[model samples]
Every structure is written in C-alpha cells, then in structure tokens.
Target: MNAFEINGGKPLRGEIIPQGAKNEALQVISAVLLTEEQVIISNVPDIKDVNKLIELLGDLGVRVEHLKKDTYSFQAKDIDLDFFMSEQFKAKGGSLRGSIMIVGPLLARFGKASIPKPGGDKIGRRRLDTHFLGFEKLGAKFNYNSKTNFFNVDASHLKGAYILLDEASVTGTANVIMAAVLAKGITTIYNAACEPYIQQLCKMLNRMGAKISGIGSNLLNIEGVEKLGGTEHRLLPDMIEIGSFIGLAAMTGSEITIKDVHYNELGIIPDIFKRMGIRLKLRGDDIYIPSQPHYEIDTFIDGSILTVADAPWPGFTPDLLSIVLVVATQAKGNVMIHQKMFESRLFFVDKLIDMGAQIILCDPHRATVMGLDKQVQLRGIEMTSPDIRAGVSLLIAALSASGRSIIHNIEQIERGYQDIDIRLRALGADIKRINTMPKQH
Candidate 1:
C-alpha cells in the first residue's frame, strides 16, 4: 500500500500546471476500440486508472505504443473476444467508471461486449440504465447474471435512431455517441451532455471523419460513417486538477499559478470557485491564485448563507464538490454543499468533522458546512484516502492543519493526480510518499 505523510501548516508557494483530465482520457481511449486504425493521443496523464485501462486494452489485443512519457498511439486493429477476458473486464469495470463506455462501441463494431461490474467510487449506485437504454435504441440487447455480476451486450448493425437519455450522464452520453458514430444511419441524441470533455470526444471523432454536428450543445446529430480513420489529438488540461490546485493554494495561504488551463474549456469553473470568495486574474489561459490571510465565503445580499451545488453541464461539476467542500472549511462563513449527483460522495465530511470543522451531514448526498472562517485552525491527524477526490480533499485538509498528518491509500490519489506528491512538494508542500504495511500495534 502507498501513503502520504504530510507535515501540516506549510504554505504552498510556486507555479504548477494541471495534468490531463483522467475522466476524458478514459472515455477517449475506450473510443479507440471503434476503429482499426492507429490513433495518436497526447497529453495523457500517467495515472493508475489510465495505466490500468491501457493494460486492459493491451490484454484485449489492442496495440498500445508509447510515443513519449505522456503520449501514446493505440491501434485496436485486432481484438479477441474471449468470454473469460470479458468477464474479467466486468469485474474491474467499476474501478474506472469510464470503462463502461466501451460497451456500446464494442457491441456495435464487434457484435458483442461483456464487461463485469466496473468499479469506481462507492458514492452511490451510478446506474447504467441510460447507457443500456441508448444502446438498445441502436439495436443492442443486454443481459446480466446477478450471480456473477456479469453484463453482456449484443447487437448487429446498429441502426441510427433518436435517443433521449433518461439523464444527461457523461458516460452514458459518450457511450451512445461512440456507438452511433458508425451506425447504419444518422442518429440524434437529445439532452446530450455537452461538458468540455464530451466535446473533446466529439471533436476527436469528427477529426477521424465522423459526421457529428452540434459540438457543444445538448442536442447532437451524428451521421453514421462506414469507418473511422487514424487521427492525432491532444487532451485538454484536467479541470478537476485545476480546481484541486485552487483549493490547495487557498487552504495553504499560498500564491501559485496554473499554466495552460484551457480556460475556454472551463465553462463555469472560475465562477464556481468565485462563490467561495476567490477571484483571480486570468493571464491568457493561466490562473494565478494569490495568498489570502482570511478567506471568506461570499454572502448573499440578504445576509443568508449561500449554498454551492453541482448539476449537469453548464453548471458546476459534481466531481469537484469534495474539493470545494474542503475549501469551504477554511473560508470564513457558512455554506451548504449539495452533491446531488452521487449518494456516498459526502462520506468524507466525517474526516473534516474530525479536524475541528463544523459540518452537518444532511444525508448521503448533502452537507451543510459551517465554515471555520479562518477562526478555528484544524489540527493534523492520520487520514486514509477513501477515493480519488476524497484523497485529495484529505491532503488539502492536512496541509492546512496545524501539525503533521499521514494519509494512507494514496494510490487512490495517484489514480487521478499525476506526480501529486512531487508536484506539491515543488510548491513547498512537505509531503512524502511511502509504501505502508501494518505496524506492530
């Protein structure tokens, strides 16, 4: 196991660049299965989940070549449909929630797809109903064996049709788009997710000759192309990582700049973070957060506490709520954080509560965080990272605390944040990464 020992109360000072978006890369990489031509993708973060997906793709007969440390070329010219391998994939599917995206493309192109229950954050039951429903509209049938937790999909010659997804799920939207890109006719998807990450996928597909219209809108029209050709694409910087860095700088009372942020892609990130009373000058696409001694949450004109909630595209992202929640802890006011998308996402609030912050857990999906408002400084304690976002949240909490803190299960953090300890350490963060075993207690 891996863990981070952080010496708290140290202010981070330095400039940092965010890594590529893990969520985007996951879905984009899976889309490679739709073609038999070589696709060169750059700006790929070398994280655990991406590495795992690459390994999984390689094991499934895709040839993945590393052009550079953070760039790769993939060609799924040949794929072996072994039932055992498909079952193994399903068993690990939830590990990277994005892996489910391959189901639609695989069924459409290869006639069948089997992936065991994919693993990811245990925040809630993220249903694949919308994904399967969209796939069904394109001529796919699904069956599941509860005993083995196996999911299998089969379809022959996906037919283009209108698909209205139940919810604008990011993954579900990508799944249908991937499948419909090569359907027998034109496909229309309404209520489609238009996140920048999804837009990137749509653009990449367009580059490879897919007739996709409405690049950045909720309604997408894709005319089926017989095949997709090889293309080169670069991933946008990870907005989640950018948000995490903003939280890190604010909590540590540090001055730091984030480079190459792709601000155009960050539709509402700047405004969302502003709700916590932070406003930074944008130097081109870079953002520089200055150190503030006393950060305050922006209050309403009527003097009532404000709430920060996440929603579908054009709104704040649900993934960054954990980071925002941690930032609210140090801010000088009360703000309620409503994480409407996931059930267990607020489980990390208990850790903040342990650190002398006041947070009322309304339920599995919401928390009313009464900010310390820079009055009560949190004391350091040992922490275990439960998930990717939570791990980073704990790290932020630890760095802003009064003493030393040890964070275990750091691999969860590594699954998303690339060279996290090294990067933070460069910014004056006193963090050490080490392998851990049971201590004689």
Candidate 2:
C-alpha cells in the first residue's frame, strides 16, 4: 500500500488538467461487452478501479489492446460467459457494480448470464432492485443466490415491456438499458438515471448503432437493435475530478485554472459552487478559480445559513460532497452539507472535527460546518483513509492542516484521482507518495 505525507498550510497555485471521468469510463468500458466489434475509447483515466475493471474484462476473454497512454481498443470476440459464472466471479465482477451490468447484456445476447455480488464505494445500501426490476420487465428471470452471492439471469429472446425503475439508480439504469437495447421490442425506462454516466452510456450505444431515444432525459426508449456493431467513441472528461479541483483550489486559496473542461457538459456545477462563495471564470471550455484570501459560504436570501445539497443530474454530484464538506470548513460562514445518497459518507466529519473543525454531525447524512471559527485552523495529523472520496477529502484536509500529516491507504485515494500526488505536487503542494509496509508483529 502507498501513503501520502503532506506538510500542510501550503497554498497550491498552478494550472491543473483534470483526468478522464471514472464513472463514465466504467460504464463505457462495460459497453464493449455489448458488441464484439473493435471499440476504441480515449482520454481514459489511469486509476485502480478502472484498471481493475479492465482486468476483469480481460478475464472475461475480451481482447484488450492498449493503443496509447490514455487510449485503448477492445474487441470482445471471445467473451467467455463462464468466466463470470465461476467462484472467482464472486471475488471479481461481483465486487464492482459496473461488472454486474454484464449480466443483463449477456443474458439478452446469450440467453443466460451469471454475476457475483457487485461492489463499489461502501457508502451505504445501494440496492439493485431497479436493475432487477428492469430485467424482469424485459422478460428475464433472476435467481439470486444469497449464499453464493450470485445472480443467475436466464431468458430466451427477451420481449421488451414498459420498464420504470424504482429510483434513478445509476448502475441499475445502466444494466437495464444494456439488456433492453437488444430486446425483441421497444423498451421504455421511466424515471431513469440521466446523469452524465447514463448519458455517456446512451451516447456510446447510439454511436454503436443502437436506437436509443431520450439521450439526456429520464424516459429512455431503447429500440432493440438486431445487433450492435463496433463504433469508436471518446470518454468524457472527469467532471467529478473537475469539481474536486474546483474545491481544492478554493480551500488552498490558490488562483488555479483548469484547462479543457467541457463547460457545457458540466451542466450546473459552476453555478452551484457559486452558492458557496466560490467564483469561477468559464472561458470557452476552461474554468478559472481565483484565490480567495477570505473564502466564505454565501447565505440565503433570508439570511439563513446556506445549504449545499446533491441531487440527480442538473444538480451537484454526490461524489463531490466530501470535497465540498472539507472546503466548507475554511469558508467564512456556516453551511449544511446534505448527502442523501450515502449514510457512512458523513462519518468522515469526525476525523475533520478532530483537526479542530467545527462540524456538527446532525445525523448520518447531514453535517453542519462552521468555518474558520474566526481564529481557528485545522492542524495536520496522521490518519487512515476509509473510502475513496473520503480518502481524497482527507488529502485535501491534510494539505490545509497547520503541520505535517501522514495519510494511510492511499490506494483508496488512487482509485479515483489519477496521479494525484504528482498532480498536487505540481500545484506547489508538498505531497510525497511512498509505498508502505504493514507493521511487523
């Protein structure tokens, strides 16, 4: 494992290029299983989860060839469904929520599919009901084995029907859409997850010659294609990384500019952060974050404390909540951070509070942060990462602390941020990445 040692209280000031979107890449890579044709995806981020997923796909018998640093071409001409149905399946694909998506597409195409329990951020209980609900509506029978932690979906010539998801579960919507894209008849997904992730998946499917209507809307009408052929598509820039950078610049009191961000693709992220008293300059496709010597949270019209919350698309991303929560600690005023998607997410505030941050954990999903305390600063200390987002948040907190800090479990941080230590060090942050060994007993 690797750990980051950060000497804090340093202002990070430099131009940082955001990496490719991890969430979008996860779904885009899985889209390869939809066709055996050669699919070339570019601008891919080099991260643990993405690499692990690529490894899982390789295990599935997909011919994955690296074209360049951030580009790869894959052809699933030799997809072995049995690879995903083994005991190893429980330890492999079931560990990633994205891998579970393979089941729906495989079942629709091969008439049978098996997947182990899916894994991702252990933020909270994110169920696959919406996904299975979509599968059942598409004429597939799901046999979930709790003991084996596998889902066996079998069906012959799936007949599409009206499919409405319970929630806009991102992966669920993706899995359902993948299955329905090649069904016998029309499939309608109501109240679907239309985030950038789902949008990119729909676009990739469309580029591959699948008839999917409502590219950016909740009602997705996937007209089952006879067969999807391979077509090349570029992965979207990592918007979450972009947002994370925005928060990082604000907290560091640095005037940093982000280059090559598709401003239009970001929806309302720029405007939402403005509510936190973070002003950004959007010129063409780039974003400029100016240094704020006295950063503060903006109050509501009636003088109530500002509250930053996350919602579906056209709203702030839940992934960036941890970053924003840390940023709020340095802002001038108080603001409540509400993360409805995950419960364990807000638990990291205790670690922040230990560093002298005035964060009141109202509950499992909400935290009230009183910033700066007029004369207080977060001091650096040694800490362990609990999850990916929290790990990155701790890194940000460590950078802003008064002294040196050591962060363990950097693999969690690496799972999302691509070359994060190098990227942050470029911005004048004294961060060093070193491989660590467990203490011998």
Q: lDDT of each prediction vs. the true structure?
A: 0.87, 0.84
lDDT of 1 at 282: 91
Q: Candidate 2: lDDT of 64? A: 97
lDDT at position 177, candidate 1: 96
Give the alpha carbon lDDT tens digit for every residue of 1-441 in model 1.
777888889787888989989989988999898899999999999998888888888878899999998899999998878833554665556466667877876876787788777787666788989899999999888898898877878887789999988999998999999999989898999999999989999999999889999989999999998988889989999999999998888888889999999988888888878879776779987999988887779877898988888999899998889999999988888888998988888998887898898999998877888788778899887777778998899999999999888888787788889998999889988889778752332
Q: Which TM-score value belongs to model 2?
A: 0.96
Sequence-dependent TM-score of model 1 = 0.96
RMSD of each: 1.7, 1.8
Q: Write candidate 2's Cα lDDT for 164-240 as tens digits.
A: 78888888888888888889889988998888778888988998888899988999988898888897878778888
